[model samples]
Target: MRGRVDEKLPMDGEACVQAMMNETTMTKLRAGKKKFKRSYRLQKDRETIVYSPTRHSALPECTKRLPAEQAYDVSNILEVFLSTLTSRSSRVDREKAVGPSNCFSISYKDQTPTLDLICTNPETAQTWVRGIQHLIQSRTGETIVNKKERWISEFFHAADKNQNERLDLKEATGLLKRMNVPISSSHIKERFQEVDQNGNGDLDLEEFGQLYRQLTFRQEVEDLFNRVSSPGGTMTMQDLHRFLTQEQKVQADAETCKRIINTYEQIGDVKANDCLSLQGFTLYLESKDGDIYNHAHDQEYQDMTQPLSHYFIASSHNTYLLEDQLRGPSSKEGYIRALQKGSRFLELDCWDGEGGEPVIYHGHTLTSKVLFKEVIEAINDYAFKASPYPVFLSLENHCSVEQQRTMSAHMRRILGSQICTDSDTPDPSVLPSPHSLRGKIIIKNKKLPPDVLEDEVSDEDEAAEIEDPEVQARMQAEKEKRRKELEKKKKKIKLAKELSDLVNVSQAKHFHSFQHSQEKDMACNMSSITENKAMDLVKRQAADFINHTKRQLVKIYPAGGRVDSSNMDPHVFWAAGCQIVAMNYQTPCDQMDLNLGKFRQNGGCGYVLKPEVLRKDYLKIDTSGKIPDKYRKNLTVRVISSFQLPSPSEKSTSSADPYVKVQICGIPADCAEQRTEWKKNSGFHAVWNVAMTFPLALPELAMLRFEVKDHDSMTASDMLGQFALPVDSIQQGYRHVHLLDKRGGDISPASLFVYISLQAP
Candidate 1:
């Protein structure tokens, strides 16, 4: 009777076994002990996944959908930690914290949550663990710890044929090639220099590891194109057209489409039935002839013809602290990151430190300190890696005479031949351009004269002032205090001159009358003033300051009251052609955003050429505060559509209803931002027909920032991405405006199709 009953039972268990045999594996599990299993079914040619649930007694079926935007990040879950190793019995309630013996939790980057998941059985737990591991391995190439373990041991053994434990340039290049990173020889040289901090020509295991980690890896061209190719490993003309128009959102005309096909199609010459093979597409993307990077200028174009004062230099203030001015850790990372971002001018507030060495920190504050030699070493290693321009070190000297000498020696030693030590050279009437000072480090500080000492006093002078006894005594005491303070200042000035002697390229001086500045010609009389003082000067002596900046260098730093490290708008001073409009680089505000946009020009070399009018010593324009915008041009932008729009926030599940904002940020009163209406339920593909117009003054110095945002009714819109382009570089007609990430790297496959037009007023 039991055999007959078993034979007549339903075959749902067999159906579940058959479903398990499929490619997809089980993932989600029910909270209770009903033995529920859920697995994801990957949709073909899309990122979407379907959740199928099955019970021990029922057949498998898809119960829910997992959209791409809200999909679980199984790949980021690097490891699974069991409760036994993670939980502490004394600290945590055993019942609530460690729910079950079979329960486990996953850990990922910077996110270690406390949780336990219940598994029905050992087989179920093993299946889940295997599935997660496979997912992680399939997505991320390798964990950093694993890469470190394998890279040094495996790569060093393969490359060090001589068993010297170090590799020269040639060996390093070959090893990189073997790793499938086809880095250029020139790029390899730059990378070698950046890694070889001690100036040694060879890289040991540690240096090689550093280079290996920083080496940017692009997908092998062939592999990349093949992944996107259609059936038979070839893409048709229509396929390429759809990719450009749909995926990239680039509206290339018919002729342009044909040109692209001819450029990339590898099967044969482009014809009516021509198709693109993987090799051809790879060639197009990798070739220097492509429109993408145009690597031809990467190593070739080093513009040094313009004067140093003629370019708007990217500058940073209090560059040692990583956080607020009041309390922050002073590290060399700030200098490294700033220079890597193409900053040419760096400020250092130097004070005496341990063992007679100078240190960098926020003066009179609780911020931690770092050795001045470390900052110089960091600068030397990274100054020209991103931009081949010269670096200007603006020194705020607060050290004693002996410590000042130590600071100078450390700079000379760490920087070596890069420091400009030609103090005895005849002063030129005009300043040298960045072209002439490439790979050089110039110091800028106040050089006080020996005559700044106070006048001598005698008993005869004390008898001259005859008044009431109380008044006379009070005045004498005040006079004595002033004389002592003056004497101390004079002594400090003498010490300041010792450090200032190293400044041959630029000299920091006080701004007096315009005539006083013109009296000196040898030193390129540069002035470093607070933004408040600069604004006051502009209010009282606008014409004189503008005329002076045209010939000499002027750096405007944030006010002393900015304890929070807030930055002032650089455009206010940039309008007067102030060469170095310095700002606190660590702070992220509207001013910093504008600074990024202004320096995005000239290949981001941290030197942008000033407009012709601002470069001239005299202009027939108004001396009043108002800008003459009538003489400027008009800009018009037509927003068409956008594709592959990412979610506003990383935690958002639903797609965003995207919109566009066009802005011209600068000193002109007419500068304002305009936006297009939000596309209704557009999701990842937004389509709109709208135009925005703005009046631009000083087009050569102005910045056009394009912001893409997601519309929300409950809260303010979230910014997706932004791209800042110089007004002069705005390409006319139909073109794609590539979006840039917060760090200012191009975000491929994310773009806006727009028609840009400019008309002279």
Candidate 2:
């Protein structure tokens, strides 16, 4: 049964408030069969949840204290759901260990373990779950003023020691240090005294908030406001309309400007007058309307009626490995994480196991194994969680006929009707569109001829697995000898009919030549090529490769020499119209960032419609830094300033000297980068009003990447944050580019202000 845990809970304001205020006793279930009774309560700030051992528990006195270490931030929570919504194996085990209806789990970010709690009853469980979910939803929908107030309140509470609800000079200094506010102690004291209205040495939460605003005031924002506002210090609706159309590049009229004023203008009289004050203008610039990414493309805005081959699919290679290919641990979590990140194509290296079952892992390597049945179950549960597009299982079968049959049975049993088999009988001349195959799972594996029996043998060459450094070095020393031995040892493996019949839409076949593929004209067949081989084909027969991809599917994966699981630049393959460029999802680099940015559009459904040039046969693509003048776009970007950038150094307590790097990644003709001068000791507010221009050959296929790094003379610079998006989706005019950490999590309130202008050649 599909889990309903992800569904939104009904709002129970009274019950939620009560649950947050009172302590609820529950049983904490941990891994390795450990359980303890604990009392959980949400902190008064509503930003943290703390728990302590119950009075009846046998835990030590030191652990029973309600310390800060025992709390978790509410912002870190990804989901709160009943335990019964987990995978089948986990559900059964949790049900048996703790009564089913009373158990719940909190899934957090950054690969943290889920917190499993068993309440005294179902009502109590529902209360906690609804309360947590309510808080998360409220935070997500909070207004600018509410968010800022909460942020200031959280810091004030953190600095207010001794539970006195007030902060003295020492406490205020500590808070400023924690906030990384680059200011002198004397200046801080002066501001503190000014905000201390009653002349008391200590300040309350309201007083502390005033002090924070004084220290973190944005002079850059004030200057921009003055440039746009009237002499009376207020912007009328006409003024806003002009600013939107001319400065932000947005097409806005009086009605639209009025709506924006109503949404972001905080003052009652200013909003009633259909005008925006300085504070209201600031909120408007920081809101989603002013974001760099075009919000219009935030949903399923693309034409989904195109054939599957006419779209780029987000795919993963070695989807089960959590680390390096040689000795990484293989778990179902890898599959879970990939699916959650909108990966529609998952690779499974299946081999025979100890018993009659099959397992998935890197073959002939030290990587740990996970049961194939469990992996299938996990896939069934998470296939459509992030997206409703059809998922593809790219199977690399090395199992014997018996184990292969077992694998097929497990897939059929766990996935049920979601698995598409040969009996579906898709048209052989053309593939189906993503819209037609929604909520389905398609298998991509080798299939036998109709007349062939299960015992019939077929020769299939497996890609060489990544080995240990020493083993790889030895093999390299005797490369020709090793090749000869491998060729001699290649044997014909029997194909099981049960497994073979599952392949229908995506039948794997050996790729011969581009001309040969065109002659065959079979749309259902696909081929997997290594990055090196694919690049070679691109260099030799660029037009032929493009024509071939327009008809059929091609997947390019990392070469086996990359034991570190590094990824190649996917833009090259994408420019050639290759639909699936598989990446090692476990690795993080610029290539992965590009991958994420490319698919981030179209509702992040893992299917991005290929550019018109790539989908049509008549249009020719040139990757040699030459393009027709008609398709060129003159793009100008001005890096205006940044706000609240995080310090890159963990060892140094001082601020950072941040610099911005702007890059255009696309066809060879459009690939270029420019860097701005670093702002010294100004992580909080760095201004660099520098402009750069690029002539992009193909704007539809180009991506704009903005990276902020801390400059250091003694060592390589460290990355603070980055944000990337397609050039086609960039909103023109002044916009805030919200930054993300290396793992792609949002670093809120940390963003760059940029001005963009795109003109046709």
lDDT of 1 by residue, 274-358 (tens): 6666545543443322322222333334456766777789998777767777667787767866776668999888888998889
Flag regions of model 2 displaced more than 4 Å: 2-14, 17-31, 34-40, 50-71, 84-100, 198-201, 422-425, 455-463, 471-491
lDDT of each: 0.62, 0.82
User: Model 2, residue 468: displacement in angstroms?
Assistant: 4.4
Each prediction's RMSD to truth: 21.4, 3.5
The residue-by-residue lDDT of candidate 2 on 1-761, one tens digit each, is 42223235564755685667688787777644566678788776778887877555463334545544388888888777665423432332322223335677776654666688877776677677778887888877677678778877887886776868899988998888777787789999999999998998989988998888788777778898889877898999888888998888788877799889998998999999999988888888888888899978779889998788999999998999889887778978788888988999999989899878899998766789999988898898789989999999998888999999899899988888998755554576878889988888999888888867676543334446343465566557666664664556434578899988888889887687998888874899898887888999887777788788888999998877788888999888988889999998878788888999998999999999998888887887655546778888989999999988876876465688999999999877788999999999888889999999999988888999999999988898988999889998999988899898876777777899989999996
List candidate 1 segments past 4 Å from native. Answer: 1-259, 264-303, 423-425, 448-498, 513-515, 519-523, 539-542, 618-631, 650-652, 667-670
Worst 10 residues of 1 by lDDT: 456-465
Please give the range of 10 consecutive residues that has the lowest summed lDDT in model 2. Answer: 88-97
